[model samples]
Target: MFSLSSSADAQVEPFKGERIDPDVTSGHLNHLTPDQQAAFNVFKDTLAKAQLYSPERPHPTHDEPTLLRFLRARRFDPQKAYKQFADAEAWRKKHNVDALYATFPVDEFERARRFYPRWTGRRDKNGLPVYVYRIASLSGPLQKELNTIPPERRYQRIVALYETMTRFVLRLCTHLPHRTEPTPISSVTTIIDLDQVSLPTLWQLRSHLQEASALATANYPETLSTIAVVNSPSFFPTVWSWIKPWFDEGTRRKVHVLGKDPGPTLRTLIDPKDLPKPYGGELDWKFEDEPALDDAAKAVISEMPKGPVVFENGEVRRPTPPDPADVSSGES
Candidate 1:
């Protein structure tokens, strides 16, 4: 590995994690007082000694602001944080996260985006990547493709996609300009638009939502700073009630339920200039834009490869015929 010169190191700014001050206004440990930092160190050291520790595993340094993200999520309770850290480490191994990251499934992500429409777009006011999931707009051939997967396999694939995509987004955060260590960048601000969601749609998603909540809370741990559920319908309270128990106190508190006009809440958390047009923000960025989905995703639904075919202008078009040579060679 190449080493940074002393001159290069000197230019590196001291992040909140490197300071003992409680007055730091930004970054991962911004909320941590000097006393809290001291207490957290004990927990961090304990976690490092746990059986799940792997020397080769990629993680932020012990003193890095990112490490404190998990600790802070557990309210600086070392034992609880250790369980989260250890479990996450084990889950990564079991899921072969390293391999997944190295070889990202571009086509699969393209397919998944059609169904989920969740994407990491521009940074929020705090510089956290904005995660938007248009829950009400689950259409296209990808929906059929996702449904075709057996429940058990679907669960695994969904979990893998969730974790993998999260890591990918966080990785992208590292490259954003004007970023400081830890604090906001370590967490994401999410908007789950529930407009047009029917009862049947809610029922179909119940299991996947449950598994996703459990996986995120247990494994990802404190990765979400905010979850603004906008455009919530009358039935949303019932749906929220069913899923509310899945979240921990910290997570539940982060969730903000809003009605059709979520502009005010979104404006308070995000700069109006950074907000999407639908949410009363000025950002020209649209969910269907490829940039919003990042490099891992393909073009918008219409331009994507046709598997089961998609509804175009309110009509379902016939699927394109498979390539004869590809079929003969048994290629996907």
Candidate 2:
């Protein structure tokens, strides 16, 4: 159990609450003590022996940070980490992650966004990107459209969306500049707003939630640093009880559920100025084509590869990413 300090009260928190030194990249075992580093090597060797080969391409090389993520996720157990690593690699191969990344459905993504806005816009206090989701707003016509789809097709689409979103995040993090040196951003702070959630909506979306949770823990590993579920309705506890078993201890500990007012809790991790207005912040912004964001926020937004945006009313459009070479040169 790591000691995490809540910035709000400066109180010692439970779980793996150790501060990730801003200089440290996610999973960089070099920061570990000699014994831990040695153990990580053995984990890698053991992982190589596992049948985690990919037909799509060569298996990704296990870097220190990446290996360390798996090790830490499984509590530094080399055997367990190797199994988890292999399972994730296998899942990637089965899902064809490369193809999904290359051919993302911009239109479908926009529709989904309109139905349920998901985006990473502003940086939290720690300089890490914040991925926000408003599930309560995911009702109405968008839900109807989803309902029309066949079960298998719906499952496939959800998987694709998850993969695309994950890919987009990976790209954004890849381009993000280090805060100082050797600390490339690798994780995101998540906010799931549940202000107006209903039982019907929750029940309908249960599978999606479960799949997403499983994917995050089993596949994505330690990509989520902090999670805040704001505006939880009265039924949230009952819902959480049913879903709690799905989340690993690490993931569960990171999640903080807010009853109604999320301002105080959010302020602990983010500045009011940086947060969007819908969630009790000063910034006025919408998940639309043109957002009411300030200059600093706009500057950060410019770094992202622009994609299609769908309004609340049914409409479709697309925007293209800048040239990869151009993006690369700009980042450099």
Best by TM-score: 2
Across 1-332, the per-residue lDDT of candidate 1 in tens digits comes to 00001111111221112111111233255666776777677876786576343233363323244466667767777788787777776675566544443344556545555454354456666566676777656544545566787876555555545543444455445444434544435666777777788877877767656766676666656567666666767776566556656665555555555667777667766777768888878877665554343222222222322222322233334323445574455332
Candidate achieving the largest lDDT: 2
Clashes of each: 3, 3
Whole-model lDDT per candidate? 0.55, 0.56
lDDT of 2 by residue, 225-270 (tens): 7766667777766677667677666566666655466676677676
Q: Model 2 scores what on Cα lDDT?
A: 0.56
Candidate 2, superposed: residue stretches over 4 Å from native: 1-30, 49-64, 114-117, 161-167, 174-181, 287-303, 306-332
Q: Which residue pairs collide in model 1, if any? A: 27-183, 28-182, 28-183
- Residue 264 CA error for candidate 2 (Å)? 2.5
Give lDDT: candidate 2, residue 122.
Answer: 62
- Which 10-residue window of candidate 1 scores lowest in summed lDDT? 1-10
Clash pairs, model 2 backbone: 4-17, 27-65, 28-65
